[model samples]
Target: MESIARQSVKMCPFMQRAGSVQGLQVLHNANLPAVARKCPVVGHAMSRAYATASGTGARRATAPEPKAGSANEMVANHATQESLFDYDGLFETEIEKKRLDKSYRFFNNINRLAKEFPKAHRDLEDDKVTVWCSNDYLALSKNQQVIDVMKKTLDKYGAGAGGTRNIAGHNRHALKLEAEVAALHKKEGALVFSSCYVANDAVLSLLGQKIKDLVIFSDELNHASMIVGIKHANTTKHIFRHNDYDQLEEMLQMYPRSTPKLIAFESVYSMSGSVADIDRICTLAEKYGALTFLDEVHAVGLYGPHGAGVAEHCDFEAHRLAGIKSLPDKSVMDRVDMITGTLGKSFGTVGGYVAASQRLIDWFRSYAPGFIFTTSLPPSVMAGAAEAIRYQRSHLELRQLQQLHTGYVKQGMKELGIPVIPNPSHIVPVLVGNPDLTKQASDLLMKNHKIYVQAINFPTVARGTERLRITPTPDHTDDLSDILLDAVDDVFNELQLPRVRDWESQGGILGVGESDFVEQSNLWTEEQLSLSNNQLNPNVSDPVLGNLEVSSGIKV
Candidate 1:
């Protein structure tokens, strides 16, 4: 450890060397007992190194402590041993001089580029660029109704909510918004957080504390927020492969049936847009007496007959999805244990909410540090979100438009030889093998074609699975589709990337494209025969239910 420390110091720049020297002085004058109490080898070695470098007397190690805790523990001594000039050859990099003689070379270069190459990295806004970078699913954020609602709230409530939820910030609007969220998700109570990331991170940590011997069966591809929550909880967790329901069941069966377990996952996985097997997973949770936490951040406003989400509406209980009893307004009066959603993405605002039993809401209010430490969301923002949700729920046509746009884009990408993950929802991704190439493609799209799609890279995605994430929203007109697809073709052609086989080409070879592949909608979408409803979501309904033409037809 000492030698490794020495090597690390040697590699460090001059200021670090100076800090180390000062640190050694503090250690040297400290009583021997105190030095041994903290770190005998580490402290003593640092002291010796500093002294030797200064051409002082031969240094010796500190003595041992008799007891683990003593008055000497706090005392640290430093004798003036090394002068700065004597420490030659100790740092060969001239790191101190480099640190002292800092010029604005990096910033100057940026300034030079800003002037000499004004048009090189010019703003594309003036050029009328089409963007597919934001995760605005329903594209309702900028909708006239949504914008009007936000404006009304801003005009009425001013800007910030002013205080924490429990304090002066507990406005009528915030309460009404929580009630609205709970009603939307069909739950008993809902607690809002500053953001979905905070909701995930704080809730799981609190649950881990409340539950005994909590064994978390987390989905491997759960968002980073969920991962952080599980970690902060400091409980043993098993990560099942992404969307692997059977593997999850196997792990669940291994645990003692009575043990407290949590099967955590997201409904609409944002990156891949692959939903979980809701019914199967829910049934397993019931069988094993484990609780379920499903994140519907990507699904809240676009699924079900009224957008209640896949688990209650789509899953194996398809019949229940349409049943009057399972409806959002009705279900809240009946069942639904837990549900979480974000206000930022589809809601067109910022924050997150958890809907569960009243008891759970009360527990989170008292225990969640994320909530306790931070100020509550402003009333204006909450009011704006409430309006967005109401408008989104009422605008069925807008939802249809979003689904249609996604279908058109996904199909066009496929025909253009882009390898996209088969998904049943609006989020579309074009997988590019190399990260550098993926970023280059993003740049090329923005620079040459005035189209913007982000290059999704690790640790956001697995290695070799990096992609240009495209989110086709209701606002993204069908007219812009050709521009995106053509730009992708150009970028890929320039990069010498080979065209990979997609579902359509693969289906044609298997003699299934026109015949056996004619399947109807499953749990993800409400539309029956829309192009977006095709094989993207593999959970097809039984063919006997209705004669659905899969080739081309808009159900809505």
Candidate 2:
């Protein structure tokens, strides 16, 4: 109901000029008689102002309409055209950009049974490809015992958990698995979630939001799930440089001693294969009076005396090497307030859990929406996971073999003049600085050599840091190892990728020597078993699989 004069004043100069007649016509077409009635006064004033001098007397003027094919007419017509509705255009743009950069991810179809394990070849279009990248470190998914237990549970309970845990979905196998996980970490209690992703997301968000004036100190390279949880909580968070203890301490010192703070980090960074300094980090946590949260997804079932994780492994080594009868006053695991891990990786099952004090777990159980609203894992999955964990806990041969294979592959790659990223962990990453060359090497390896190593690019890693992540398992024989190294060397030669300088002459980034490597291999063998004996129950044995003897020393 605004006056036309007032509306005219608010419009642009071009619009105001056009409004005298066009606005009135639009109002008439729209059947707005009330608005039209109010506009006549302004229209008349405009007409008078535009009047022209005539022979007889001054006469009102008529504005000339735009001619057909004129610029003005074309602009008017273009303005009437419908706008493009391109909701998916952004996604297409991203895909096109990635394609141009040669960073697009193409999933290679791999069909194989885990039981076939390291020897199992992936079915491609017309060839069987050798897989070099897999998180299933031990091939526990294909274990006969795990499969048997899963099948039996499936027959008894059928598929699916019927309802949410609060609504009669909780199964006995899940409870049993939880208990086993709690014992494995030596924690007071544990809670299982659909996966480690959900566990991290739920727990972090809940703690961040519920705690009073809580500040989270997170690692710069923490996994995406933890990032999501911390973001959802909308609490103040400080991100220290990845594994930089000095930066972490500096930030912690900025806050008062009474402030409630939590330091969250991972045991092993997946891409770089860099292990965190858990002992030093824990010492800082104690000094700063901050709660410690450790994510051992990549380390569980691969490190430690009983495959608990790096924290336990560090503690066990300190005690065993010192020839002490009891554990140190406080180990890394003892200092940590919470531990998070996944079953999908080493356990070869699908689930995640958080091990902590009973009260902390109960709080998560009662309040975490991700856990409370979702249906629990099926009985078969829980049973299989429990069996896998039990089988892995007692068996040291697989772990030893994996370590030996890792060392052998790394040594072979170095001998072949390949630039492998230097890290103390078991993972080996071949550096391919350019995205195009990285993809080219991966394609050549697959098509020409029948090797499958996925090219990891941005945003998984920084743009120039693209590389091929390789995991060597027990099933990969020495002959296969030679073949893999030869193929990699050929690809690098074809692509002309730069190699790191020889350690003996140039003292390159990884200065490790032959003696150090042997000592490390031995550390995982005899020393690990000796330490495990001090903590693990010697009498415990699986009735179905029987007791596994450790008489044979570690063999590569």
Q: What is the C-alpha lDDT of each candidate?
A: 0.66, 0.76
Worst 10 residues of 1 by lDDT: 103-112
Clashing pairs in 1: 25-78, 26-77, 29-77, 29-78, 30-76, 30-77, 161-378
Q: Stretches of candidate 2 above 4 Å error?
A: 1-85, 119-126, 317-329, 502-526, 529-556
lDDT of 2 by residue, 357-423 (tens): 7778777877899889988888999899989988887776677777878888999988887877777
lDDT score for candidate 1 against the true structure = 0.66
lDDT of 1 by residue, 1-556 (tens): 4444445446645325446653354344444434332454565776667667855566644355435345545564343334436456646446554334321011101110212111122343234455676766765566666667677878888888776755654666677677667656655568888998999999999899878898999999999999999998888899999878888989998889899999888888888877777666778888987888888888877765445566545531342343322333433223335688899887878899888876677778777888777788877788778777766554545556777778899889878777776666677878775677777787788779867677777677776667778887776676778778888899988987545553344443211132354322334354332423322223112111221111111235
TM-score of each: 0.72, 0.79
Cα error of candidate 1 at position 547, Å: 45
